[model samples]
Target: MGYLLAVAAAVLFGANGSVTKIMMEAGLSPAQVTQFRLLGTAIVAGLVLVVVDRAAFRLPRRQWPVMIVLGIVGVAVLQATYAAAVQRLPVGIALLLEYTAVLMVALVAFFFFKEQVKTRLWVAIALVLVGLAVVARVWSSELDALGVVLAIGAAVCLAAYFLIGERQVAKTSALAVSFWTMTIATVFWSFVSGWWELDASVFTQPVDIGGVGGELVVPMLLPLLWNVVLGTFAPFLLSLAALRFLPATAAGIVASSEVIFAFAVAWLWLGETLDVVQIVGAAVVLAGVILAQTARAGKVVDADLALTTGPITTVRDTAVP
Candidate 1:
């Protein structure tokens, strides 16, 4: 169930990038989209955090800096950058790059965090590379440089998210970390958004619900609601939980399913389809990620195999990538 929940979370989380694309098309600015995600996530995740960890919500004085940084670099940067990337590239292509966080985290685990890797892992990564090559079609004549750069930037943000989130999981419950981190992210994102640029108009009501703080005032918020609920709220909570046991890198590979989901969702909802060359390119990007994910902890002990493996031990385990 935990693994299922984690994968489900990855889907929701992964889909957010595509969701942002839809919202933007509906006439939301990048900053506006980010504002909704950051604030909406804060409200949803914050409520859950308060209910689950009300007793432990407050951290010591020293932890505030850590929380603030995590909020800015991890949540804010990741979501904002991803939104920007999808605005330019095909959803599947953009996603293929960003999900490379799995590889980035794996490498970090090896040389920095020092985690283990097995031989089969390398083979899997190699397959990923081959698959991505087929998907992206590297030999193609056309190249979208701007799209590629934005995608790479998104991946960088995801890498930061993994590294920072891993650090917090050690001392905090996933719920607590997610809640506080989200709250902080929302706050920072708001500051970046500037109060003048934000308005209630960003959220619209095509229909009405019952009542709220005053009169009957429910409105059509499917796009916005999904943004808050499935995209922002659910993903953060589940990922925070996953971070407790899974290393950032392994979590990343599993999360790579997001790439598959992105393509599927984009096609289903947006009627977008990938051509052969694009598919090949996407495969190549994923290939790099897999290679990084499966690489071993040691330097160069070249024998018969590269001996690539994923993280060993629980969150408790650490080694060179």
Candidate 2:
């Protein structure tokens, strides 16, 4: 059930790229879409929390600082940057770059946090870097430089999202954490996106509902609602539910499958297909991601053991004492 939930979440997240791109092509800026998506999701999640767990509304004052940072940097920045990258780059390529957050988290743990990690992490990092080069086809100069940069920025923010979220969840329910995070993100984006400047009638406008070559058309509000409901809220809740039964390591690896799903969905829906070499590169990068997930699991176990057992000591002067 946990595995199924995780895969379901990945499917939703993977499908979101094409949906977002469709909206972008129909006359919405990435920022506007992001603002609406966050605000809608926050409202829905907040309502759910009110009915299901009213106590979640009572957040501790101490959590405000980190939660604010998570809202601004992790949620708002990450989503906007990813949306921008998707608009500029192929959805699959943008997602591939953003998923490098797993690698980023491993490196940060080792260096900044001074955590003990297995040597395999370095090998994993190397594999991902090589795979990225192959995917980018560096010699061909086909990829957009700005898109790649934004994707990398998204990766950094994603790493921070997971790190901060792990801490936040330790002290609160995942539902509560998600609600507050989305609320904060909504507020932040509302100010930055200048959402008030958007015309209200735009939501009722007929827009293209598919990719560049697509023929389907729908009201703009439909896909926007889908973005909020299926793309963000539903998948997020599923992911949190999956963590209840799956180990973090297993869940992380399963979650990484979002890249494959994204590529597949884009290929089918948007007619964006990668070359054989890029496909192989994506596979290699996923392999490295799995390896890094294992290393992270080991690091967590090591930390737990150290905390529980303490440092080893010898009884050298216990003869007469």
Candidate 3:
């Protein structure tokens, strides 16, 4: 059940990349796209929390600072960077870069946290480095410089999201955690998202939902609605539910399938294609993700806790209490 839920979430998240790109091409800035996503997630999560657990609405004072960081950096900034990367880069390539967070979490656990990592972790590191080189074709230096940088930025934020969320979920429910963090992100982005300046007419304009050169036209608002509901909220809940049945390590490995799904979806929907060499590189990177998932020891601090965001990578909490 856990594996199924995780994979389901990955499928939605993977498809969401192209959906997000479509919205941006329709004239919405990355920040505006992020604003809509975050705000919608917050509202939906808040409503669910109200009926399921109203007590989650009241967070302790000591939790405020950490929640703020998670909301602004992990949720808000991470989504913004990812949105921008998708706009400037192929959806598959952008997602491959962001998924580096899986390796980042493993390395942080080994070095800073002094966790007992498996010998295979070193092998995993080598595979990821080599695979990324092949995928990038760094010899050519053809991809946009800024797009690569933005994707890397998203990786950093995602790493923080996993590390911090591991602890937060031990103390609170996942729905509550999402609600608070997304609420913070929505509030933070509201001031600078430039949403007010967006002309209402843009939403009414026709957009090509078919990225494969077909003329499947729809109002821009349709995809935007899909982005907020099916793309973001639905997947997030599935990931969180998966944690209930699967150990963190197993969940992380299954969630890593998102990269594969992302590449496949983008190719079919947006016509993003990769060379033979790059395809092999992607396979190698996926093998590394499998190794990295098992690198760190699995310790369930709280059996009831389900710690994950939309992207369901897991990390051991190394912070001294």
Candidate 4:
């Protein structure tokens, strides 16, 4: 069930890319779109918390600082960076780069926690790099360096998301963590957006309120709301649940499916097509993800066992942060 939930988490995260792109194309700046999305998500997550887990929502005073930091880094920065990256980079390419947070976590463990890296681990990383080369069509052309940097920044922020989530996974409920984090993010985004004048060109029509236009005038689509609900809230909640059941690195690797799933969803929904080379690259990325998961376990049977039987017991939380 945890494995299925983790995969579902990936799909939800993937779906966000295509949907967010649509919203952006409608003229919303990445920051504005993210602010609106986060605001809506905060409302939903908060409602769920008040109704289902009110007590958990109230952290002790000592934990407040930790929660605030988590909210800033994990919730605000993690999402803001990704939205900005996707605004400039191809959604698939941007997402693939972001998913490299899996590797970042593993490296964090190796260098900081002194965990051992095996031969296969290195091979898997190599495979992913080679695969991404094809996916991004790097040899075909060069694009904006800043766009690439944003993608890398998004990946780093995502790594922080996992690392921070892990810090509280054992002590906190996933529901609580998600709810509080979103709440903090809402505060953070509100401040960021308070001074900025919203542009009128961000949507197809002026925003309607009771058949009236609001002062801001930014409009929206039905699908954009659906995107906020499913793409943003649902998947992130599932990821929090996965964080409860798995280590940061493991959750990250499993979540890598989010990118490939993004490719498929974009192809189907947004008419964003891919070439045979890109498909091959996606395949290689999947292979590397699988190889990396197995290599970390130190035994073929354990790896196969994990894939076949969901997350086995040996995929421990030790040394994971």
Candidate 5:
């Protein structure tokens, strides 16, 4: 059950890339889509906490600053940059770039935190760098410079999420941490999302569903709901549930499959295809990520993994990809 739940959550998160791309292509800016996603997830998570365990809301005053930083930097900036990267890059490539956060985390732990790291860390970094070059096809200039930059930026923020969340989880329940972080993210986005500039009718507008031929059309609200509920909220809860049985390291490995799922979904849904070289590059990068995961075996907390994982979930145990 734990394995199944983890895989299910990974699939939802993987599918989110294509879903996000569809919304962006349909005329929503990355910021707007991110705002809606965080807001909806926040409301749903808040309601769940309210009904299931209202005591989860009673956070200590000392934790408020950490929650705010997590909301603004970890949730808000990380997601918005990822959305922006998806708009400018292929879904798979964008996810691949984000997955580098695992490498970044390992490096940060070794250098900044002074955690004891294995020699494999250096090899993992090298593999990822080479893989990124191949995936981007640096020789041909196939990747967008801005998109790559944003994706890398997302990785940096995701690294911070992992580092900070690791500590935060030590002090609170995973559900509480997720809820509060999302609440803060919602508040932060609400101020800068330019909600006042958005036309109300846009939500009712019919837009292309963005598949192979771009023939399907649906109300904008459908995908938005899907993004919030299935993409973000459901997967998050599923990941948390998985932790009841799976260890953090095992769950993290399973969650890493999200990158592969994202690639497959994008290819099937968005008609995005990568060349043989890029595919090999992606495989290499994933290998490096797995290697990094092994380097810090049993060191990562389940709650931290949940919050920092691929796309969404309170106890999400994502790849931070």
Candidate 6:
């Protein structure tokens, strides 16, 4: 059940990359799409808290600063950068860039936080760097430079989410952390999202759901709703529920399948196909990510892995690429 749940979450998250691209192509700016996602997630999480744990709605004063940081940086900036990257780069490549957060977390834990990481971490780092080089085809410089930068920025935000949430997850419920952080993200993005300028007719307009040369069409609201419900909130719950039955390391390892799913879905749905060399590079990077999932020896490694594994986890996990 745990494995199934984790894979289900990964499937949703992976496919979400395509859906996000669809929304962006339908006339929404990355900031507007991000604002909508954050706002929708906050509402869903808040509603869940109302039913199961109303106390979560009232956080202590001391935690406000951390929650604010998590909301603005972790959720807001992470989602915005990711959305922008998706618009400018292939979905799989964008996700691969953001997933480097796992590598960043492990290295930070080892060098700065003084956590005991396995020696395998060094091997994982080398693999990731080499794999990314191959995937990016840095020699030819074929990938978009600005898109790569945005994706890397998303990785940095994701790393902050993991490091900060590692401590808070011990004291707070994951759902509560999600609710507060997303709420903060929604609030932060509201100022910059220019959401008011958005016309309601935009959602009612039919848009091409297919990417590149495809022809399938749908109401823009359909994918937009899916982005909020199935893409973000549903999978988030699935990942948290999976944690009840699987160790964080195991769950994290399983969640790494999101990258593969992203690649497959993008190829099939968006016509974003990578060549044989890039596929091999992706495989190598995934192997390193799996290794990184288990490289930490500290007890908190479980929390760390849980939050950093899947794409679009919450504060205790992601709102990543």
> RMSD per prediction, one decimal?
8.3, 8.6, 4.0, 7.4, 3.4, 3.9
Total clashes, candidate 6? 4
Q: Work out the TM-score per prediction.
A: 0.74, 0.89, 0.91, 0.76, 0.92, 0.93
What is the C-alpha local distance difference test score of candidate 3?
Answer: 0.78
lDDT of 6 by residue, 72-139 (tens): 88888988999999999999999888888888888898899898888888899989999999999999
Which has the greatest lDDT? 6
Candidates 3 and 4, the one with greater lDDT: 3
Clashes of each: 29, 0, 0, 0, 6, 4
Decide which is better by lDDT, 1 or 6: 6
Per-residue CA lDDT of model 2 for 1-321, tens digit only, reads 878988888888888888999898888899998888878877887899889999989988988998888778877888899899999998988987877776777788779878777888888898898898888999897889999999999878777766665545466765676678778888888877977887888889887765646677889989998888887777777765666776666566677777888898888888888899989988888787767766653422111100001100111111111
lDDT of 4 by residue, 1-321 (tens): 566777887787777787677676666667777677767776776788788788986688877886787777766776777778877776777777766665665566567867676667687788889887877778885444677688778667656655555545446665566667667877887777542676544435544222112233345755457666877777766755665666655665676676678777777765666788877986786677666655544312111111111111223433323
Off by over 4 Å in 4: 1-9, 194-196, 199-221, 236-254, 293-321
Q: Please give the CA lDDT of all the candidate structures.
A: 0.59, 0.74, 0.78, 0.63, 0.80, 0.81
Q: Mark the regions of model 6 whose C-alpha exceeds 4 Å error after superposition.
A: 211-214, 298-321
Q: Is candidate 1 or candidate 6 better by TM-score?
A: 6
Worst 10 residues of 2 by lDDT: 304-313
Cα distance off (Å), candidate 4, residue 223: 3.0
Please tell me which model should have the higher TM-score, number 4 or number 6.
6
Error of 5 at 137 (Å): 0.9
> Would you list the clashing residue pairs of candidate 6?
312-318, 313-318, 313-319, 314-318
Instruction: Compute the lDDT for candidate 4.
Output: 0.63
Off by over 4 Å in 2: 212-214, 298-321
lDDT of 5 at 226: 91
Residue 19, candidate 5: C-alpha displacement in angstroms: 0.5
Candidate 5, residues 48-70: lDDT per residue as tens digits?
88888898898888888887888
